[model samples]
Target: TSQHFDTCLGCLACVTTCPSGVQYDKLISATRHQVTRNQERTFSDNVIRTLIFNLFPYPHRLRPLLVPLFIYQKLGLPKLVRKTGLLKKVFPRLAAMESILPKVTVDSFRDNLPEVIPAQGEKRYRVGVILGCVQRLLFSPVNEATVRVLTANGCEVVIPKSQGCCAALPEHQGQAEQAKALARQMIDSFENTGVDFVIINAAGCGHTLKEYGHILADDPDYREKAEKFAANVKDVQEFLASAGITAKLNPLIEGDLTIVYQDACHLLHGQKISLQPRQLLQQIPGVKLKEPVDAALCCGSAGVYNMLQPEIADELGVQKVENLLNTGAELIASSNPGCSLQIKKHLELQGKTVTLMHPIELLDYSIRGVKLLRK
Candidate 1:
């Protein structure tokens, strides 16, 4: 634990205020003891302390690991696991994480795709839409909204034929080598396509792809190539806003709908985008925009943390959902897919009708004649 505990403690002053079982001062003393060679590093100490989880854990078994995860959600195992308490022994923090457990939705974004859309038309700009693995498999509707809005705004959409994981999943899990390989492949595939920009619906992948230059800075052939590719990656929301696509004047629903906007970690922290979506959404005729109390904090659905570090993720997700209640927004708006599911589930568990949706869907609704979102 000392391997990273010291650095973690240094970064997070909250460790000093931690009232958890692991006394903060004791952890600090343990770190000192380990550094003084008084204790041998155990396997957990080595793996947990050092942030190299993705590298070895995923290893050559990425697809298998990810597939089971997808299938588990599909089978509603997360909810069952929460209900059964079977994992409480193995994972003592299971109950602490239950509130934030983003249960499986009725339809994952993947099942709703067009699988194949028409080719590039004679539009002013033709861009390659990077439908990331997570976005494609879980948050597919975001992509649909993105495509609908983009196509309606006079741009051609092309899902790269040779795209795979952008290396975000592996990179986050500490599999640097695998992630780098995927990033290189992504660059090669997109460069050959001759598109104006790479549109990304998921903020996480957008941030990761934007790091292609840094991730490949050591490679000779890929350094400049990666740099060039990373420069073109655009978050779907930012891209639309930059293009001056005004939300269409449509007759919105007559009933009441209060919406709160959650600034996803990547969209705010990584991309540093603040005004685009907010300003765009404000253009809507009859929509009340609500802001969270803790305006700047991670929702804990940071990548696969909801499944891996369930407790901590759940704690953060529920706290986020509670913060949303302060604004009384009936719906949660997020740019990231992971945050959407995480917030959506917490709200559902509370017996509240607060739903998770993308800002683009709202923007699309305003732009299009009718609400594209299905009930």
Candidate 2:
């Protein structure tokens, strides 16, 4: 039973496919919770799980480790190590983990952004944004781009300092109490903002944020507040589409760049959002949107699935990468950081030069009339 639950990626793709309206998401979560309580694990498995849970959810702890990693990258050690296969020989799992680390900027966007960024022109709507746990450390630029795009299009963005993890990790792993504690903290952080919408750039976090009501259904104190909170939760793409773009976008150079839009499982299946992100991408002039062969398939970055089940995750990543490469696209746009990282690792392993970006990043680049940076 534990092995069966472990194999489940928690992508919620089955939820969309089931004709019987089965609540597979809830079932999986409950099963995983039972596994957590009842099952015993090998020492190595216990260590890996403990390390991941302890590290990924805390940006402060993660930041210290990035210093050495940043130095390693700066010194070109990553390339040398990969070339020599030293990591593969000594630490295979760590090698796989290192392959997905994005280029670390000297200063994270979180350090620069203020609590509130006022709209550029006329203020159309006031909104709150979630700066997620791993997202804040690894993909801070996405949040920065989201804020810039929102403000450029006449939305006042407020980022509460009190905000913490969306609890998607714990919730997906069946750590119900930890997930609920985090959810309660987040609700307390954003509830007083009086914003029209709560924006999230990470698809998994967005999906989890929207389900806070269900997660906290049994809490008498939080039940009503959680429902209200969930109602306002919106993926950045969903909010931007509904609010409409007020900024004028410039076309890419030469008026041509093929872009493959990879749908994050949470965004498409969990949240039932498919068209809005594509609509936003199409709005940019000179950008051609192409769908992968298996558009409905998962890229295998279902939360921590890549870290836990690296072999299976790599297989899915390779398959997804092949589909994207076959499109002959110059760029890949995805909303989730996990998908972006997973795709990027596979692209690198395959010796591909295509750039991977968040949908908002592309929109920001177009609006600012800048070129998309490639890896």
Error of 2 at 206 (Å): 0.6
TM-score of each model, paired residue for residue: 0.76, 0.96
> TM-score: which candidate is best?
2
Superposed Cα deviation of residue 362, candidate 2 (Å): 0.8
Give the distance in Å from residue 340's predicted Cα in candidate 2 to where it truly belongs.
0.7
> How many steric overlaps are in each model, in order?
9, 0
**Model 1 regions lying over 4 Å from their true place:** 1-80, 91-122, 246-251, 371-375
Q: Residue 113 CA error for candidate 2 (Å)?
A: 0.8
Off by over 4 Å in 2: 84-86, 89-91, 373-375
Model 2 worst lDDT window (10 residues): 104-113
Full-model lDDT, candidate 1: 0.66
lDDT of 2 by residue, 1-375 (tens): 778888888888899999999988888888898999999877777877888877887677788888888888899988888889888677666767887888876764246679999999999999998988878888888888889999999999999988888999988997889899999999999978889999999999999999999999999999999999999999999988988999999875565878999999999999999999999999999888898898988998899898888888999999999999999888889889899999999988898888888999889988998875443
Candidate 2 vs. true structure, TM-score: 0.96
* Candidate 1 similarity to native, TM-score: 0.76
* Model 2: lDDT of residue 27: 82
